[model samples]
Target: MTQQELQARYEAVMMNAFGAPKRVFERGEGIHLWDADGRRYLDLLSGLAVTGLGHAHPGVTAAITAQLGSLGHVSNFFASQPQVRLAERLAALTGHPDARVFFTNSGTEANEAAFKLTRLTGRTKVIAMEGAFHGRTMGALALTANPKYREPFEPLPGEVVFVPFGDEAALRAAADERTAAILIETVQGENGVVPVPDGFLAASRRIADEVGALLWIDEVQTGLGRCGEYLAHQADGVSADLITLAKGLGNGFPVGACIATGRAASLLQPGQHGTTFGGNPVAAAAGNAVLDALEGGVLENARATGAWLAWAIEALGHPRIEGVRGRGMLLGVVLTRDVAAQVADAALKAGYVINAPRPGVLRLAPPLIATPEDLAGFVEALPGLLDAHG
Candidate 1:
């Protein structure tokens, strides 16, 4: 019943993969969460950018209820209306009407599917950006460049190269005819919410084309209106051969998709890949509800409120606060010192929930529905919080 009790039980049974639980969240609504102790906190992380529609969203709940009451899941052997409709919606959103969708249950699985799709290009090498975090699975892990995450799992899938995140020349040098795909994150979310350098994406596209490699953009954290756009790469006017999505796709519902466009759409053949519960009706319905909410002013609010939050943070001009980086709701508050962990802990005590993805970077991905008032409160509290920790 209490946070400590739940934490004890969790540690006794759970795998300890994520360390100790921060708090036992009992319930949430909009951008707020209540722990088991009945303490309330402003949730700025949005469950690591998954809850775009926020907790217990009425539209998302209603869609899930209706779909479950009607037809929940029918396996991949048979198609369901919601599943087919969601696929069409994703294809259209990709700016490639004829793009094919391969559904998965999580972002990692989506990246796994994309990894396999790359192999179908008759090439073996995959060039991924440095400081990239694709996923944890074996195939996706190979593409992830973090040494800490990859060292434990030795002899991972081979022929994977890592290049500087925003270096066009490095990418050009790494890519070649043998490169099956060039995987990149439009904005490196796990790498402190860093945005891709200007012109880097377009340059990557051109280089990939010259090398006959598929350009794969990982939009798991920046897609579905999280970064003020459907796909962050779209703002750069660069189209990818394969785009992997997940985090905000189902608004907290477990769902992901690998969208393949142009000739790459036909790469994966029948029996080559399969999923037991990838595009079930329930997840599809939830995905549709998230899209509905995004279309209905949530996206515009993200753009407006995000700009306001960035401006407010900059206006503080605190000595410890370096600057704010990122687009839309996905932001990272940079600090002059590597005390982000202390700041985040202090923020928790001050009734706020944020994350220090790096030693000096605090990542903020509040719900898309968060208002300017909510962000203003965080900005106002941030200075004192940093001072206390610093």
Candidate 2:
């Protein structure tokens, strides 16, 4: 079918919560997507940092097929190898030997589980960053900082106080003995792929320790190699009491996890929290495959290539290009003017995929598997996009 025909079908059946469709993508390979009209475009967004292993990855596909052959899913009442193995693998990544996990279907659900854990601390107040985006669910929404997403669903889950994103002084002032948890996103993706300031995570960990509150780091967008590390806090050499992960966990297969460490590990009792099909065999298998790729040097590529892309773009001498912020594949190209949306739209029309999360910030979160050549394509076309749109 033509693009217009597919778009018409989509509008007829789908809800308008996400606005209109850009293109009816038919298929993807590596870091490229093909639309209904068979136009090829470089996938720089990676489905909002989910498909880190790239489209139709053989490792993910093989694992999913093999798990389906053996056993697909069973109730949480009974344990499965894939599920247990995945939990163990991710827990080990925390570098905390006694880490525990609660699985969920998406980042929001993972945050929901973490929220309930906070309630178990016998405290109701939560300290969140000013530009953070946790998720859209009630509990997760409570921690999200944007009024636009929160005002519509007033009377959110808890008494959440928003502090400046990287201001340690404000964070210290907001947090106290009554604070149950301090929620920090390693990188504020929705607020324009902004990485937390240096030493910010360590300051948060210190403040949480002082207040006797859990340090909950939301790694939904920055974790698992997206930002050059398995967890962004690893760079700070500090461990979080609670860590929520999703997006790239299953490489496009819907799965998420809320991992707790130290005393926070045993906070959730048996009946306190549960999920029907959170980490079923199929999803776990997919997660395992993505992990294999991350461990097999895909992470290194993200680090090196991401740096090169930033330098290359700046090397263009484009006056509109102010600079770049963020680490690894998650970057926000800061434009001199508020033409981010225009540049992104022009790029898409020119057969590349990126997004404008804010007025002057263009977010680029390509797959971890994206090579220098692939990003070079986008950088080469960036000048033209800016020239036309800026």
Candidate 3:
């Protein structure tokens, strides 16, 4: 069907939460996507950073095809090989060999599960940073603290207190025995890819330890090789009591996991928490395949290409460009004016795809498999796009 026809049908049937769809994409390969009209555009957004390995990855497709051909799902009543193995691998990634995992189908669900786990500590108070986007669920929204996202769903659950992002003094003053967990995203992607101040994570760990509160790192956007690390928090040199992951976990497949270690691991008993499609065999297979590709050499590519792309963009010396922030492939272009949205729209017409998370910040989260050469096109076109739009 045509893009216009599909959009009309979508607007009629869909909830309209995300507005009209951008375009009816016919297919995608590697770092490029083709709409139904046959126009090609570089996929810098990576489907909001979920398609880590890019579309139509051979291994991921083969794994999903193979898994579905044999055994799709047997439910949580019985154990499946892919589910068990993926759980083991995920637990190990948390740096806790015996860490426990509660699987979900999306990052929001993982955050919701983690939200419930915090109540097990007998504390409803959660310390979350301002400008942090946890999720839209009622439980996760309490920890999110965004007025636009939370005000509509007022009377949220939990005693979630908001603090200035990266303020050590505010965090230290807010913490006490009543606090359940200090939730933070090492890199606040929603706030224009802003990474916390240096030594912030370590300081949070110290404060949480002193107050006997759990340190929960929300790596949903920055994990799974997106930031050139197995887990973005690894670079902080502080281990979290709870870690939630998704987005790039299953590449494009829907899969999420909330991991807990030490005393936090045993909070959920047999009937405490569960999900039906969280770690189904097909999802597990996709996750395992992405993990394999990431571990093999895609991570290194992300690190190298990310560094080069960031440098290359800066080297352009465009007058509208202010600077760049964030780690690895997930970057935010700081613009001199609040025309990021216009630039992004212009970029879409120019055969590139990007988004403005904030008024003056354009977020670029390409697939992990993107090479420097693949990104050079976007980098070269950015100055003209910004000039025409900014």
Candidate 4:
């Protein structure tokens, strides 16, 4: 069917919460995507950083195909080899060998699982950072501080205190014995790619320890080599009691996990939390393939490309650019003016794709496998795109 016809059908059939579709994508290969009209654009955002291995990655496809041919899913009642292997790999990569994982199908579900884990600690208050975006689920929403998103759903799970994103003092002052957990995003993706200040996460660990609260870092957007590391928190040199991951875990195959470490791992017993589609064989195989490819040159490529992008952005010499923030492949271009949305739209018109999380912030999280040449091409086009906004 035509793009317009499909869009109409979507509006009729699907819920309106997400608004209209951006463009009807017919196909994708590597970093390029084609709309139904055959217009192609570079996928810089990588489907909001979920497609870490890029579109149609051979390894991911092969793993899914092989797993589906054998045993696709048996629900959480029956355990599968791929599921167990993926959990083991995640626990190892998380740097806590004793960590246990609870799988879900999306990042929100992972956060929900972790949310419940906090409850098992016999505390209810959670300290969340301002400008945080955990997810839209009720439990995740409680931890999310934005009023525009949370105000609509009032009387939510209460006792969530919001502190400034990078202020260690405010966070410290807000914490006490009543706090169950302190949740943070290593790099705030939806808040326009804001990274926690240096020493901020470590201080959080100290505070959590002092107050007897669990430190929970949400790596749903920055994990799985998205920021040139297995988990972004690893770069901070701080171990979190609970870590939630999803976006890049399965290379867009739809999987999430809540890994709990130390005493936190013992919080959730069997039947306390479960997901029907979590840890399915097909999703686990896809996750394993992503982990396999994350090794070797793929991770190095992400680091190099990310570094190159940051340097190029800084070198753009555009008077309108306030600064560049974030680490590795996850970056936010802070415009001096509130022109991020216009700049992103201009980029799409120029055969590139990017996302504007806020009016002044343009976020870019290209595939980890993006080539240096592709990086250069985007860099070369960026100045022109920003100028077009002028």
Candidate 5:
């Protein structure tokens, strides 16, 4: 079917939550996608930073198929090998082998679980960063600071506070003995790939400790090697009581995990929280496959290629280009003018996929497996593309 036909069908049936469809992509491989019209485009957004292993990776496909053929899902009542193994893998990766895992189906659910876990600390107050995007759910939505996203859904959960991102003094002023948890994104992905100011995370840790609150790090977009590290907060040499993950964990598979470490692991007792399909074998197998791919040099490739891309984009010194923000593959191309949406649309016409998360910020989260050559092509084309659209 044609892209227009598919779009018309989608608009007629699906909710208009995401506005009109951009294009009907039929298939993808590596860092490339083919629309219904058979035109190819390099995908730099990685399905909003979920497809870390790229599209249709052989190992992930094989793992999911094998698991489905054997034992797809057994619910949370029964123990599944893949589920247990993936939990162990995540525990180890978090630098806390004893950390407990609560698997969910999406990043929003993971954050929800963490939100509940924080309540178990005998405190109702939670402090989140400004410009944060936790999720659309009621509990997560309360922590999200965007007025547009929160205003429509009033009467959200109460006692949630928002402070300036990376402002140690603001955080300190907002946090107190009543604060149950201090939630933060190591790198504010939804806020234009903005990394926390250096030493800010460590300070938050100290503040959380002082107030007897849990330090929750939301790594939904920056974890699982997306930022050239297993967890972005690792660079700060501080560990969080709760770490929420999704996005790249399952390499496009619908899976998320809320990991609780130290004393926070035991907060949610039996029957307090659960999911029927959270740790099903299929998703767990896919998660394992992603971990395997990352261990097999994908992480190193991200570091190398990401640095190259950042340097190349900055080296261009294009008149419209302001600078680059973010670490590793999670980058935001800041523009001098508020034409990010125009640039993104022009990029689509030029056979590329990117996103304008903010008015003047173009977010790029190419697959971790993307090569320097692939990025170089985007770099070479971006200057001219910006000139045409900027």
Candidate 6:
């Protein structure tokens, strides 16, 4: 069907929450997507950083096909080989061999499991960072600090406090013995790829330790090589008691996990938490494939290409670009003005895709496997896109 016809049908049948559709994509390859009219566009956002291995990866496709044919999902009643292996692999990737994992279907669900684990500490007070974007679920939403998203959903789960992000003093003042957990994103994804200040996370760890609060880092958007590391938190060398992941864990397949280390891992026993389709065999297999790609130099591509993109964008000398912030592939080009949304729309028309998490910041987290040519093309097109927007 044409894009307009499909959009019309979607609006009539689908919920109005997401508002109008932007474009209808039919197929995708590495770093590129084709719309209903077959017009191609370079994918710089990577489906909000979930397509780390890019679209239609051969290894991932093969793994999914083989696993689906053998055994897809057996529910939580029984165990699966892929599930066990994936869990162990995930824990090992975190650099904590003894870390235990609880799988879920999305990032928010993984966080929800972590939230319940926090409650097992006998405290409901959570100290989260301002400008944080946890998830949309009631529990996750409660932890999210954006007033715009939370104002409409008032009376959410309570005892959640928001402190200025990356401010050690604020965090130290807010976290006390009563705080159950201090959740943060090493790099705030939805807040325009802003990396936490140096020594900020280390201070968080120290504070959480002193106050008996769990240090939970939300790696949902920055894990699994999205930032050229197994997880963005790895760069800090500070370990979290609970680490949540999802976006890139299963590549394109839906999967989420809450990994807890040390005593935190023992908090939620069988009956305490459960998910019907969390560790389904298919999702496990997909997770394994994603890890394989990460271990097989897809991560290196993300680093190299991301660095190249950063340098190229900087060299553009565009008047609108104020600065660039972030690490590896997760980057935010901060505009001098609040025209990010318009620039994003212009980017789409110019055969590229990007997002605006903040009004003045254009965020880009392209596929980890994006070729240098694709990266260069986006860089080359960016100046024109910004010019048009201006």
Question: Which one wins on lDDT?
Answer: 5
After superposing candidate 5 on the true structure, give the runs of residues whose Cα lies further than 4 Å from its correct spot. none
Comparing 2 and 4 on lDDT, the stronger one: 2
TM-score of each: 0.99, 0.99, 0.98, 0.98, 0.99, 0.98
lDDT for residue 378 in candidate 5, whole number 0-100? 88
lDDT of 4 by residue, 174-198 (tens): 9999999999999999999999999
The local distance difference test score of model 2 is 0.92
lDDT value for candidate 3? 0.91
TM-score of 1: 0.99
Off by over 4 Å in 4: none
Worst 10-residue stretch by lDDT in candidate 3?
Answer: 137-146
List the candidate 3 regions with Cα displacement exceeding 4 Å: none
Stretches > 4 Å off in candidate 1: none
Question: With candidate 1 superimposed using the best TM-score fit, by how many Å does residue 73's alpha carbon deviate from the native?
Answer: 1.6
TM-score of 5: 0.99
lDDT of 3 by residue, 1-390 (tens): 788988899899999799888788999998889998898989999998899899999999999999999999888888789998999999999888769988899999999999889989998889999999999988888888668988988888888899999899999999999999999998999889999889999999999999999999999999999999989998889999999999999888999999999999999988888899889999999989988888788889889888998899999999999999889989999999999989998998888889999999999999988998899989999999988975
Q: Least accurate stretch of 10 residues (summed lDDT) in model 2? A: 369-378
* Local distance difference test, each candidate: 0.92, 0.92, 0.91, 0.91, 0.93, 0.90
How many angstroms is residue 52 displaced in model 6 relative to the true structure, after the best TM-score fit? 0.5
lDDT of 5 by residue, 1-390 (tens): 999999999999999999999999999998999999999999999999999889999999999999999998888889899999999999988788679999999999999999999888889999999989999899999999989999998989969999999899999999889999999998888888899999999999999999999999999999998999998899889999999999898888999999999999988998999998898999999999999889889889999999999999999999898999898899999999999999999999989999999989999999999999887888999998899876
Each model's number of backbone clashes? Answer: 0, 0, 0, 0, 0, 0
1-390: candidate 2 lDDT, tens digit per residue: 999998999999999999889889999998999999999999999999999988999999999999999999898999898889999999999989999998899999999999999999999999999988999999899898889999999998788999999999999999998999999988899998788898999999999999999999999989999999998778778889999999999999999999999999988898888899999999999998888889899889999989998888889999999999889999999999999998888999999899999999999999898888778878888888998976
TM-score quality measure for candidate 6: 0.98
lDDT of 6: 0.90
